[model samples]
Target chain A: MAAVGTPLNRTLVRVRKPFSEDRTTAVVATTLSVLALTYPLIDRALNLGALDDLFPIVVYILLALGLNIVVGFAGLLDLGYAAFFAIGAYTVAILTSPSSPVASWLPFELNFWAALILAFFTAAIFGVILGAPTLRLRGDYLAIVTLGFGEIVPIVFRNAVGLTKGDQGLNAIAQPNIFGYELNSSTLWGWWYLLMLVGLLIIFMARRLRDSRLGRAWMAMREDEIAAASMGIDLVKTKLFAFALGASFSGLAGVLFASRYSFANPSQFEFSTSVLLLSMVILGGLGNIWGVIVGGLLLGVFDRILSARATGWIQGLGDATGIELLEKVNLRDSRVGFFGLTLVLMMLLRPEGLLPNAQRKRELEAQATPEGEVRVDETLYDKRGEPL
Target chain B: MQDLIQALLTGLALGSVFALIALGYTLVYGIIELINFAHGDLFMLTSFAALTVLEAFAIGRGSPLGTKVGALFLALLVAMLFGAVVNVLIERLAYRRLRNAPRLTPLISAIGMSFILIQIGQYWKGSRPLDVPRVINRLDLLGPLDIGVRFFLRDLILILVTIPILLGLLYVVNRTRIGKAMRATAQDRDASALMGIDINRTIAFAFLLGGALAGAAGVMYGQYTLTTDYQRGFETGLKAFTAAVLGGIGNLNGAVLGGLLIGIIQAMSERFLQNGSAWANAVIFAILITILVFRPSGLLGEQTPDKA
Candidate 1:
């Protein structure tokens, strides 16, 4: 596509040399982002009020960024991550919702912005509390405990009828008012702009964290915990940081989610929610920041927006074509099955995921050959609760 | 005292079902050390298998007692066979490749398999728990004793299924050549291989036996609870795994003991505490965390170093 010997082409190539060895891909990505940002504006201007659909996608991506820190970077598989998200949402709901038990008990209502900030710390503290004990446990045991926590937390929230209103959930959660100007969920542009701003900030933070010293420590810890510990990486502190920091972002995402939907329910925070988040991290390719984005967006959009519509579209096509099979198939019930299939297929076929981490890629390559002929590998936890 | 007796009986029934499932976990963990996450779902699916078999025979409450019992025995056989095959297939297909990879890879794969199994259960059985038509007469077997405690045919069903299966498993593990091979392989895989034992075959055998027991537990579980659901596995599986760990993960007898203890605790907690069944799962899980914290080796666990 480059015009050979053209002056403009030579100038563009010279300008792009510092960014990367290849420039077209970067240029395309940049152009796409710019276009994406403007499309919302265009939609608004054209009287289309569909900007609210993006709120969930943006919020989920934020949560993915948080989970990526713990699972992707620290190498801890947190199966109960949605508990933190639940805590975040529930914390906001309890504090700000007029019908909430806390509101009735406390006799004082907290502002949305204040509650939003508080939710982050609240969720982070919960993460640290969970991480403190379970992080000491490794591999499968750790995973099981987290899974238990994930189940137990939602059940507690659901059963604590006096506070969470049982299964009915909290409604009319206070929406955020920045500088006395109310942010409305119906006004698509305001919500979209705010979501995008938070999205960019978290993205920037994730990129920075990836390159920082903590990131290296996480990598070292993930690769070989004994080696990292011997290297004086302060394993406990490093891990807690990963858990707390990861949880903090999930809290923010929850605030946005609650404010947009204006509801918080115990049913929203199930064990499957944690699984969905974990799948996103794995699907994106562990240890790669950009891949998490791609994975989260791919999953979030498909699950939230496209799944039912696509199924209906196919059904419509079948009805038109008089094909009996396609019209009767319900995609909703098979969502979890699809998730399960995705996990199995991805692990077996592409464990490195859509984006591959260089070190992990190397690790996968090394494992490509047979490690042994016919002997069992130590796949169980030893006395120290570490995988042998 | 009467409540205690009733709870005691209930505990035994629950414990027996748990023991059967826990045996599968312990056997596989003993041999391969991989936590088969899908084991629970596999167990759950076995109920559906049993359901399908019963339906095929048109076995329902109206069926004569003789026919009902016969049909159930046949269904249990089919369920066990299906469980064994599914467990073996999962290992061969999903886990065999990552046998030597870092421990997490296979664990995730197992989790994936579990999700698929759970979803399949939902699809097969629908999202809700299905009522198992009570073919077994729920006549109180011990009502004549008049000790103020009632025991039904359903409670006795646990014993009928568990005792035979447990005895059969003990015979197989203690007396069979494959059992010896499994023991040798668990002790030292490399040396076992050097001694001409087929490691993969031994491991697959362990999975088959484990899966069969889990399948048996599913049938027993359905009969005792009088309901079977797609999601039943997660709850039962969690408790059974806890039982496995509590009893010392690799120890066969330990799993049984642990299962009994958890069953007693569940029944006692639900009985003695006011409205306790709602908090039963949380209580059991709490015990698991406490046990893991204080005694990671579990009650009867022997601290064996890496088998390599």
Candidate 2:
């Protein structure tokens, strides 16, 4: 009874390194957490009216982290990631919104906290349903299927007027409450702190997953699918887990988004949203958690703050110079163009991204020269992961 | 039955235009495995070019038949040239360097290019839809023949333009030396390079050919729909890409067949299904997912050896 075989031992493996082991990661994480915690105070002191506008962007960063798992870790290209976001938002909207069809059909409205939990599972189920059939296909084909699914989901939401309210969408979703205080749009500090916590939690979880056994399997599969499978990895299971897990994160984001906005609309989730999230992931550096956070923040600031300000500056120049052409110029609606340019230029000039993952940077640099030549010696070593 | 036949005729006309665009996708994909996401936006830009030409000539419905015909022909050639030049430039500047990069690299670049082109389109035409003056006669060709179903002159024109382009494309790919080089390069880029084929030139030729087709399709689409908008590219491109995928992505004949089938389905759905206009796109997307999952090879596509 005291020692049956091997005395009951709880500790099997050490998952995390001591803080001193990785000074850079530790310092960066601490600095970011401190800054995030103080951001509302900073915004208030500076009189920057950006606090409200910047709220949803935290959710976007969460989304990019989720996408990183599938695209970066598993090496699956998902062009329809926004569909999962939409599904999650709709789940929360339907369960908690007073105007939802559920209000008429069911006797009780689900609690916001409970609905948030439900949204994650609902979106994950949808992810499994979509991923099961297409996971076995080639990478590009999987992209097309996901793109189709993205297009179809919004259409379903728009057409099912009874369930989704068609184009009008669901309104008056319940906001999160604790004790005597409620978290809504007006409580900017409340939401700012809440989202910051959620973001930190997700980052912690994503990092842990990245360093776990499954993470290694994902990297192996990404490098060589056949070799990974031959090494006894279950390809479909590994892929499906990444897909569903990624989807659940988006679902969580969707709930936060709907609750904060107090509404869910079909127009909010579109192909452009998917592309925007992708650019953030790529811009930050795929597969790197910190890189994605920085990338998402830069883009969010640019999208929410700088883009509009740039238009104003352009008009101001035009007014100062009395130049009609300059006056008429507007970059306010040119977000798509800017994102597009970012994608192309980044791919062409710095495909490894702004904060390149060490291994990916090595793989990319080793693959090509300025003249697009595959140096014979480099190719041999890069392919089989050998240092000659 | 009459409605069905009429729908079929309209579908065929629409299908012909889709086929032209799908051919461009198929040809480019056949040679280079990129999806050319900007191809649809290029089509949009070409239609704007055609509109500029028509407006420059001041050609309208009231113009004499001879003037109308001359202006349209000029527009077609100009649009084709414009499309070909831009497409080649895109290949040289945006895509060539990424040829040997990861497969996703080029695809993402193409998506970026699509967005850029779309922005250009918005700047050129503004956000509102523009009306294309009816330069062709609206008389029904099948009326005098008493076929019991109406077939408009526009439908005839689409068919007439399409058949020649299809045949000419077939001849070029099957019989021409440049075509031979294209096929060779597609089979093996390094092997073709060893054989002294100028790989870049051959690829440029494919883009030129594809762009020309897109230009022609643009002109026909403008006249058929009588309206063009910057956003038209996204919708039309999605449908044409679906057609390309449905037919077996790299096969020329398969693209045409797929285009026609998609057109028929769209038209029939619009005519028969409740709220069909709104639901039509959803149906196509559903079909696309189903096909990719169940049969990635498509109707006529051979099992691509690259899947492994």
Candidate 3:
């Protein structure tokens, strides 16, 4: 087993704190720069009532960040992230809604901030619960098991009518309120955007964690668990922390999602959402924060733009072709086709991802091995693709 | 007593189907250590293919024996061909390219292929569940003990037919030249290649055999359930995969035993456990987790040098 800072230590480490003098200045400058650059588009979109278009992007960005911790930094494939999102949303729903038991327990009604805290903890506890027992399994087995958990959670939420209202979903979930002021109606977007800003702050904190000793431990475990353990990295605790923290963000995202939508439903948290989140991590380049943000925004906006315009595009093509069957093409269904195609193309063209971490990029580049040349050793190309 | 007997019978029948599907998962995982996420979708496609072939036979309106026999043979052939072609294409297009990539890369590709297959199926058959025409006769015999023991003769015959055939497959896998080559390839791909075995051909053969079994399972499942849905394979696939893992993923006989155990467990849980139907999935996962924790190599799994 290699020591933490040995020759094989290829883990990328950002030494500066995420919100340190340099990073803060960079963030502020970038924000100002971006705002200045997109001023015209922002103005036009806002003028046209397209501000809501940014909401899903914000939500997805947060989801992507949360998932990156588990799947990217920690190298744990989680297919049930939406379950945590569902949990957070349902937590908020159960606490703030007029129908909730939480309202009855309090002297006065608890607001969204309080509910948000509760939701985060509720989802986090569930995350820990789920992660505790299953974190010991091997990687692919972990993925399948998590996939099962993802499938099972929603079904439970949907069928447990006494608690979750089943498929009917919890409606009339209250929006967030800060002290005397209430964020309601169209104004709700302001609060949601603020919440997303806070989520970005959390992402910054997560970025810090990614560079910490804990982060190094996670990377080690991901590279080789046995080796990591041999080097005295506490496997159990480190894995639990990854699970817990990854799930905490998912829970937080759920709170924002619930409050933004003002509804909590099981249908919203499906297996496909998990796939989308995973794709975001992959597309953005795992272990790269900025890449994940870009990936999330691209996929989120792509989904919205494509779904809205796909029918029109299909209709135009159908008209040109004089084919009635083509006219019936539903862009909504075709979105999945687009996602599939994108993944395939991405794998073929840039397997390392759009903004891959330096180390991951190098690893992928190393595997290409100049196309036609065959490595002589038969054991060299095992499942891990490493020479034995 | 009657309920117990009925449950056992149903469990065995369902277990047979699970075992068949699981064989596909185990075989592929055995050979290449790939999970073949698209496998369930393959199973679903094969079911539709069976339906298409059976429909062409006009078996729904014919004599039971002739229709059953004809539909059985035609459906199996068509389904097997579909499975083989699809599996081969999947290997070539999605998996083969990722041979040198990380484990996660191929898994993601499998997922992408799954979506593609499902979309294609939806486009062809529409998203709605299609009813498979019943062409087999059901036989119910009164027990000598006067305890009612109702049985579907088709299920009994299906199991009786499938078990022997599956056992024959086991024999071939353990004894035949191709089978030995497959084992060698699975144990060490590069070594087998160096020894003049075509690694790609061995993988294709594995996929071919796995696909054929999935096709057979689809035929049996269609006959038993009388309906096939695009999404039907998802849950069944997960369960069968669980069985494969439970019995030791790359071990052939282990998959068979695991499938039967899972099938019986599922049936028993649904019949006896509280809120059984609702919790059945969770129970299966709980069992999987337990197995993983206690015996990661699975019941009959041997430790391979290459780690996935």
Candidate 4:
């Protein structure tokens, strides 16, 4: 949205060249979109049963992409990103679910689509409310504050039995309707097509934003706050916008998650889920949209399918070999451990992530002088926290 | 008045445990300025180790007092050593290399380390809460003195064990060469390195002491509460972290004071407020958020400019 030659737009032309000039990237993106659109139908025709987990994984990717806006793009480490996810789902459930206690007080059950829109705004508002105060603090303190908020949200939801029905949770939520047909978890094909379109649109929007003036501001702030401020970037506004935007994306995913499952529960928004999403983002590559998607898909498939199958195979082998220790082995119990290992190993060996952003990869790999000073290449970038 | 006094006393005993754990957090945070997220889980592992040791000795309610004491001492030693060793290992394996990297790198790694420790605890002890055998008799110690209040022997034991350790820690930090090195490192790592102080060893020593404190807290908590679980680490770790922050993170006396205050608040709420037990965590988290926002330096911390 920035006009040409404004302070933030100096490097826009330079940054847009590489991606736009690459024909292969465009072709690969198009191919992936087409495949994503058709996968559900193919799975159904073959009775592959991949649809069951694929839908949730899509939602997860959507979430990771949203998180990328904050942790990756904006450079804010949010340990409680799931709190926004919870808020989004709970908002929709409380509004549209017949089982929700709010039904007694409210005159009508809101339409699913209307509730979804409301949930997005609700999550965004909450994001600002949380970010406004905490973002003023330093990075790590903001992390702990967000973590505190994340831990508190579920507790409040769980304890507020009158509204959320306590541990039993809100079920039988209204499903999104297309014409006369209602879409639920069983209508996997419909949900898949809808989510695929949403995901694609979001991916497109994310790309556009990445090239926009605001995105540059976020990157500027993330790289160096004081310098970004000196360059006339509003640090508070940029950080808050990123935080709110990231939250809204998670909210969108939450609405889809609740609508598909037809249930909303506190347990679904645990700290573990947040960490799992973080792992996906890190494993795929931070700050890269496609990388996040790949990371999300890889880990999601592993968690939902491969891990279980591998465990069963191991157990079967143990039975055949009569090895008692192998028979007792349970991979599910070690799932979190695996994620933890991914995080530690990734940070240690490849902090730039698997599919690092071009700029990020360069920054991480930038050569250091013998005196231990990083020599920033002035040809590619300036000290204003911009690419060029 | 009677209930209030009882709550206060119980809170003091509970606070002592939190203080121990909180020391570990404050110590590590003080030296490295990195939140050792795995410290709480380290405490949990130590508790499990202690449990296993006690189980091996078959020390239970039926055991003789002298034998029980001896077994308890052995369990304590094992737990401390286990905690210290494991903590040092985590620092070496996960955190050591990332010392010069960005702040978030080691933090994320610490979180991973925490999850791994939780997994280990789960595999060792199963997921459910295990009932810890009550080795000390629950005899009322305050009744003999006609104090018109009930203070159990367990409470006395908790205080007796914790206070001395706290004093010993204070003495070491104030009087020992290594402790001075830790303070020097905390003040400025690069400068300390330039001065020829072994930064790695000082950092490792901080972890060792912190881990020992966590180990001591774990055994005391498991024994006092009569239960231990894998998930206990996250909850207790958060509370202890809160204590550390409340008392001015990186401040020893601050952590102890914060711990006792939090314990008292929890006890008062759980006893006085309706459904307070369920809401206690929420209250603590609220306090953490509020304090960090309003007084980021904490009650006892110096007002360092926000390190952007």
Q: Across residues A239-296, which tens digit of lDDT does each residue of candidate 3 receive?
A: 8888888888888888877777788889899887888888787887877777777787
Which is better, 1 or 2, measured by DockQ?
2
lDDT of each residue in A12-95, candidate 2, tens digit only: 111121111234445666787788889898888999888888887888989999999998778788889999999999999988
TM-scores of all candidate predictions against the true structure: 0.91, 0.93, 0.89, 0.94
Q: Please give the DockQ score of every candidate, comma-separated.
A: 0.54, 0.67, 0.43, 0.68
lDDT of 4 by residue, A1-388 (tens): 5754555554664455423423434464666677797797788789878787788888989999999999988889999999999999999999887887786578876888898899999999999999999767887888899999999999989999989997889988878888888886677778888898789878988888887899888887877888999999988889899989999999999999998899999999989889999999999888888878888988888888788888999999999999998898888778889889999999899988876676666545552122377664444433333444
Candidate 4 Cα RMSD (Å) = 4.0
Please list, in the order the candidates appear, how each scores on TM-score for chain B only: 0.96, 0.97, 0.94, 0.97
Q: Best-fitting candidate, measured by DockQ?
A: 4
Model 4: residues with Cα > 4 Å off, grouped in runs: A1-31, A366-372, A376-388, B144-149
Off by over 4 Å in 3: A1-48, A101-108, A320-325, A367-388, B61-64, B141-146, B303-308
Error of 3 at A91 (Å): 1.6
Tens digits of lDDT, candidate 4, B109-159: 998999999998998889999988887898998888886778999988998
Clashing residue pairs in candidate 1 (N, C-alpha, C atoms within 3 angstroms) = none
For model 1, how many clashes?
0
Q: Give lDDT for model 2.
A: 0.86
**What Cα-based lDDT does every candidate model obtain?**
0.82, 0.86, 0.78, 0.87
